[model samples]
Target chain A: MFDAEKFIDQQVKKVRDEVEGRAIIAASGGVDSTVCAAIVSRAIGDRLLAVYVDTGFMRKGETANVDKMLGRLGVNHMVVDASDEYFDALKGVTDPERKRKVIGEKFIRVFEREAKKFDAGYLVQGTIAPDWIESGGGLRDTIKSHHNVGGLPADMHLKLVEPLRDLYKDEVRKVARALKIEVAEKQPFPGPALAIRVMGEPTRESVAIVREACAVTEDEIEKAAAAGEMKLPWQYFAVLLPVRSVGVQGDIRAYGFTIAVRAVDSVDAMSAVYSKIPHDVLERISTRITNTMKEKVNRVVYDITDKPPATIEWE
Target chain B: MVIDNGGQWTHREWRVLRDLGAESEIVPNTTPLENIKADGLVLSGGSPRVGLNAEAMGKCGEYIDKSGVPVIGICAGHQFMAAHLGGKAGPSKVPEFGKTLVSIDDEDDLFKGLPPTIVAWESHNDEVTELPPDFVPLAHSDNCAIQAMKHKTKPLYGLQFHPEVEHTDNGYEMFQAFIDVCQAHKKE
Candidate 1:
């Protein structure tokens, strides 16, 4: 029912009118932000700059994949390696909301520096309906502090230009398709990235473990879906839990952290049902994770909880 | 008009109305009854548990009593409707969230042409415990007894589960049915 073409035309005009000079968009290469970058780029042409910050918390190959994707899109984009700064800012931060806020502030600082060079006063974000809805302000209960919305620092300077604020993920995908963006159907990834995937303090070791486990989970699930063994879930990934348990490997006592494999089915992110991944697929994922990580990850559990009781992401 | 009570799905309700070709806007529950101009009204579910905190509902009771239009209450709004109309609402012994099996007890205007058993999405900490004097229960689920209800005389309805969400079966049909009710009422 959403008129993607009409929506794009209207948004481009709106952005052109609202933006006086140059603008910098926080492009994450996800469906929302990518679509947003394309829309803003069409409006202001070369005046618009897309800044992609590598938070060091991205999934394996994520930074490079995004870099190439942005280049092909023909958008004026730059990749900033703020990994060290992000890691330092998030050091010792364990609370989920606190971590999101820290990442959000860190992102703004990076964007601010880039904006200074570009002389851009306006910042565009691909914040969709669920991001602000779950972020909770006024009457709505705080479900999670999304890094883009609730995680925003009050002292932020740049004027925000959220073009897709009212639209949902499905609607955004429709727009992405209309625009022929490649990652239109990409799985939803939180702005906090791999930092939130780690339950406790996201040290280098924890981040690396979760990143590998996540890659393995994604690889197995995608293969199972492609092979017709199971239906592809709306979103799927792995979370590194801090709880460590004892196990035996090669007749040696092994103690290691746990990984949780999460997947769900939903049109919008508001409500979701746990994906009915076949036991075979789940078993494969579990074995692959434990085997790949060896003694570092002795246990891999499947999260069956729905969004009401449990959000899709562990954090 | 969709009266927003801060429910997460409040915007979803508005989106459903728009998809169904109804000119709808989300208004805060605090809006005065006279300021509302629409053929029908929907009181959206909110984080405020009506059973525990009624004052936070913000003149929703006034809208139900004074607004002359078809009204549908959802979740918190449903609880508040029952409470304001001399019924009872409280914390559910078994609170349901996410996917639920809702069985229609009556083919009311809202559930017209829908299957007997439907999949509905629920996210509620409290529920209507007792039916208001002039109201009858329309549906139920395993954990919650009164999933849906309607007034005997007034064009009033209530739903504990969310039909505006895409996960819910026949959500568009249910909303279309409500729109029909509103249109029919406007004709009279």
Candidate 2:
């Protein structure tokens, strides 16, 4: 049996012993990061500073919700509206690895700046096992460049402390439950944010298009699950592909981007089978996405590919 | 023990065995049978490109031929098993992937306590098209005909769907049944 309580007790002691002084943590408000923040806060008390960066690539309403969450937790935190910075850094970058490395280096520079302000020698992140595994080390094949693991700079200034390094996504959720964290049930969001979901170049306009598509995907999927039409998928979202197709919008020829909606069921993210979302729910999601963003997106399709061939996020 | 056939869930299969209180380890498929002294073997699921790399998966074929121990092949491993044993397997007519409802055709020791029908998790581009002689069909889905099969006289089984995944409701039950089969053979 996996004991979350025992794991929590040991991790807190480990964090307290490892983090000698003040530490700055990158709080993304996802289940992993939130649970990690809660655990680290219990260890260092007031010595921890939670920093959330609004990287413009975030999902709809992500920034505001995370801000409120930090305040409720009563953790000393700061919200850095670095959307412009991220957008500037990602300009004209299309290669997946380049995008991840750019974002990773940018994050470290931002944290190094904060680390100086707080005189914090440690930098905390919610990097779990999948982060490193998929990021691929010596013998492993690189699945995708996870920003936290793959994007990390070669010479980072601050010492890194990851409390949830060894745990899987499910284990992180258990820790969140054990600590009474409210965002325990929240679905996972990639560290690279919506950047990886945008198949090609991630521009300012491209980000806006995906943000709305993701919102619609979540709304329709969640509503259907609540209505008891189908069981909720472990993770569900929309990916805005760079490819465009011809479509008929009220008999007029329209050329627009295509959105690929994906959902999967998994205990740990190591392997996942595609979610068997009801056709009716998928139709609703398609109709809402194409109709709402008809000018920008006209074709909506569901990604039926499994994890072995297709990763959750399209890069 | 889990045979690492370059599959994504090879580790998960090992984890499931350990969780089920069975001694297990993920050994590469190329490991000699005598080296491990295992009671049974689990051939893990692999990539979408199953038929493309017969050379990479050739060792599994060798193991299935040489090792007479109780063996459970999963997904790509299942496809390879059928093909290796004079059966036919290729690109699935429907190319089934993701969650698909499977119906048990014949309840056997492999699917001992499982329900007649299950919402099993599936992820495969290729499937078993023809069963080898003496291999009996155990279960099937709408998209694919041979969802599962087992050797009539030998402790050999194959499953197209991933039983180690969390989505499968009776995943643990099936693993327990396989372990019991292994335990029985180990005693013999």
Candidate 3:
């Protein structure tokens, strides 16, 4: 009874009307945002500006990766080096909500500035159903504030437009597939990026530590998945806890912060079960995180907490 | 001791306390009064408007009444102290959300080396309009009348402003005063 083609066509048409003139879409190089950019490109053609803000909290080579992917999609895009701005804004602010809000507002401010440069009136986001649902509106307790949803400021100037607002993660993947976006099977990344993954104040140094750890986690997990050891997870990353603990590194007492690897499989982000990553893969990730950043991070741990008791993000 | 009122400030306060050379741990609001054992207690700011079934308020009141230890309450903790001692906490005429300055009323152990007026971060909808019989108002601000208060005879203190926040001027000094109180109590 699920008609994928019909739904895509109808949704595309609806969004086309919703975003009439010039608009800018947030394309993070992830499947959801990429797919959204593609759909909006088809709807308004040159009127859609895909703006990507490099928050400096992203994973390794994320900015270049996004640039290449957006180029391949033939979407009109601009990459803003807002890393210094993001770093300056987040300095000495440790609260998770504050971080998310700052990042969210920063993202909007970046896009808004880009929109001004392009004379665009609409801001397109890849926000889905679970974002607003979990963010909690009327009669709903806030589970967590999604940077794209609840974290947005009340007085944002741009006219809002979310084409994929009602769709789930899987549904967005389907749309991505229908649109032939290469990142259709890509794992979900939080809109706030690596800022939320760092438990305390998200400084450039802390983000660097988490970025490398996250890379190692993804590489090890993917290697295991490729070897048919386990199914690829829906989403996975590494979190850097603020506290430093005592640990031994190569017969020396090494005191460093702990890195937590989180992987989960889910149809919708509303609920998720922890991925059963093999012991070998976890070992590889732990070894790589510690070996790569021995001075900054000496201990590595895997998070097995489910969605109900714990959110996907440690923050 | 870090009072975990299930707010973002609870964790930050613990981090700051730990950074200041104090071994701190976050205990849930439901933790019993008898189980708490620390050199001092921090009444962290949180959304105390959420149901009081956690009994954190009751336990905190009992701890302050019996422990005779140095206690520093921030924001909601400040309101809780006022409410516990038969003072009133009504809605603020103008809620302070970000940065504001508090004028110190008298030279006390709390504001020992600090200036007469210090900038501090504030985020609360409720504030104490009146103090208990034995409570002394040590500071005041434009919107918040009782910016700081302390028990006349006890080592207990309360602050309407968040000293843990970096925006607060002389926040670290305020924290140092609380730690000094803790140290002084230990010596006694």
User: What are the per-model numbers of colliding residue pairs?
Assistant: 0, 0, 0
Provide TM-scores for the models. Answer: 0.98, 0.76, 0.63
lDDT of each model, Cα atoms only?
Answer: 0.91, 0.85, 0.80
- Candidate 3 global TM-score: 0.63
Residue B142 in candidate 2 has what lDDT? 92
Best by lDDT: 1
Stretches off by above 4 angstroms in model 3 are: B1-188
Pick by DockQ: 1 or 2, better one: 1
lDDT of 1 by residue, B1-188 (tens): 99989999999998999877889999998898889998998999998574347778888888898888999998998898998998999999999988899999998888888899999989988999999999999999999999999999889999999999888999899889999999999999
DockQ of candidate 3 relative to the true structure: 0.01
Interface RMSD of each: 1.2, 3.7, 16.3
| Cα distance off (Å), candidate 2, residue A83 | 2.8
Better of 1 and 2 by TM-score: 1
- Poorly placed runs, candidate 2 (over 4 Å): A14-23, A95-98, A112-123, A129-142, A153-168, A216-312, B1-3, B18-41, B47-71, B76-95, B100-106, B116-119, B125-157, B185-188
